[model samples]
Every structure is written in C-alpha cells, then in structure tokens.
Target: MLSLICFQSLITLSQIWLLAVMSILWIIWKSRNDVKFNNFVISVQRAIGTVMAWIREGGLLIKAPMGNSILDVQILHSLHLKGIPRRSTKVIPVFWHPPIADWIKVNTDGLSKGNPSIAASGGGLRNYRGFVKGFFGLRLSIQTAFFVELKGVILEVSFAWEKGWHSL
Candidate 1:
C-alpha cells in the first residue's frame, strides 16, 4: 500500500511539474515575443513572480484531479529555494466512492480506427454490489472517438431507462 501510494504521489507530482514547465515555457516564449516585437521590457523580478504564479496555477489545477492539494503544495513548496512562498493547504485524501444502495454505475469506453475504418462503443452498468446490470457493444460508422464515446453513453442511458433502471 505504501509503495502504491508513493508511486501515485510521484506520478501526480511529475504531471504537475510537466504542466508547470510547459506553462513557464509558454510564458517565456510570449515574453520573448513581446520584447522583440513590441519593445516591452519585463523586469527580472516581475518575470520571476510571473513564473511563480503560473507554477502555482498549474499546481492548483492538478489539485482537483489528484484530489490531494496538500501533496501538491508540499511538492511546490519544496521547489522553492527560500521559505514556502505559497500553496499551503490542509491534508485531504479524495478517492472514488461506490454508488449508494439502489444505484447503478455506468462505465463506458469507445474506440476508433486511426485509418477512418470503423468505430466501436461499449459500456456496462454495475450495481452497488458490483453485479453487472447490463452491457452493450456496437460498431458505429467511421467517426471521431469523441462521437463514439458519446454514442456509448447514450446507448447505456437508453438501455438503463428501457430496463426500468432509472435510479442510476
């Protein structure tokens, strides 16, 4: 369990770092363009602050998906050379919860051929006790993966409603 948690933490931190790096690079590119074309000169202090702000914003965005702002903040805090500049949050763990009694969960997936050959959509409904309520799989016309996914969801919902499984 500890190893799994550590691995997850590392993955989350790496994702945040990658986002921060991308954001910083974009800011740098924009700053360079302004300096070259518009003759806009940004002070070093301002540049540093801008980078920090972007990093913080990236961390905050990752917080939602990681479901642990404290871990992200701690990683961000360690990135700072001096004292922690920002990003302090109470520890919290957020994990998926099973559907309540009498509720069913619908999981869907879609696939598409890269060569515009065919598309497929599939999904299944599971009750709170992890029993399969229903499932569907179908081949669709050549379409984008997004459309295939949407079709899968629509099929699942329709199936559930038709079967009188409305409390999903």
Candidate 2:
C-alpha cells in the first residue's frame, strides 16, 4: 500500500512539472508569433507572468505558488537584473457621455463572422438622459466588415431622418 501511494504521488508530481514546463514553452511560442506577425513585443517578465497566470487559472499547478515556477523565477530575475519594470498594469476605462440638451445621440455597430463572411449592422438612438429612442438590427449577406460598418452608419442616419431626428 505504501509503495502504491508513493508511486501515485510521484506520477502526480511529474505531471504537474510537465505542465509547468509546457506552459512556459507554449507562452514563449505564442509571444514569438505575436511579435513576428502583429509587431507586438512584450517584455520577458510579462511573458513569464502571463504564462504563470494562465497555468494557475487552468488549475494545472494548483499547489505551486503564483509566479513561483523555477523557469519563470529565473526569467524574472534576469529581467530585474536588466532593470525592466516588474509588471505593467494599465487599464483604460470607457465612459459614455450623454448628448446635448435637444440632440439625440446615435450609436451604431457592425459585426462580421469571418472577415468577409456573414455580417450584421445595427444601432440605437439615445436621448440626453440615456433613454433609448429607437434601435434596430438586421442580418446581412457576406460582406467586408468595413462595408457592414458603413451600412450601419447609413441605416442609423436613415432611421433618424425618418424619425425627424435631424438635430442628432
């Protein structure tokens, strides 16, 4: 019984270690691809931190301390030696403002499935108090996102005009 328990524990520990290693490698690959294709470069520390968090979130390393993986710790130490910031926590919030007293604000949006696949456009008109005056949505045939977006604007404008909302 003791030998069986020991074997199971060893297997579990190895699995966790394997997951940790794979997580780091996967993150590096993804970050490399992002830099290559999107021109988005992330700091070494950020990449390690992201993978650490991802592994933790996936419950793969539940017993390990956050950001305490051996590889991540090593990379983080190197980044610190290079005087890079430990982490960047930048959050920008969006706030909506009401229209002026007599004017109604119209907001529109377009969504495409596969860049040039099925699409839809819709919009709503809101008063200064944020009350919805009218809203609409429609399915469209395959089209570019830009075209759908333009269609959304045109639809909103036509709707507002028909509703005698010229001040918007």
Top TM-score prediction, candidate number: 2
lDDT of 1 by residue, 16-59 (tens): 66877887788789889999999998887887788777776665
Clash count in backbone of candidate 1 = 0
Q: Which stretches of candidate 1 lie over 4 Å from their true place?
A: 1-97, 115-117
lDDT of 1 at 19: 73
Give the poorly placed runs of model 2, Cα more than 4 Å off: 1-91
Tell me the tens digit of each residue's lDDT in model 2 across 15-116.
Answer: 455666898889889889999999999898998788667655544333433232344445434433211223335879989999999899989999997799
Cα deviation at 13, candidate 2, in Å, is 25
TM-score of each: 0.41, 0.46
Error of 2 at 54 (Å): 26
Clashes of each: 0, 0
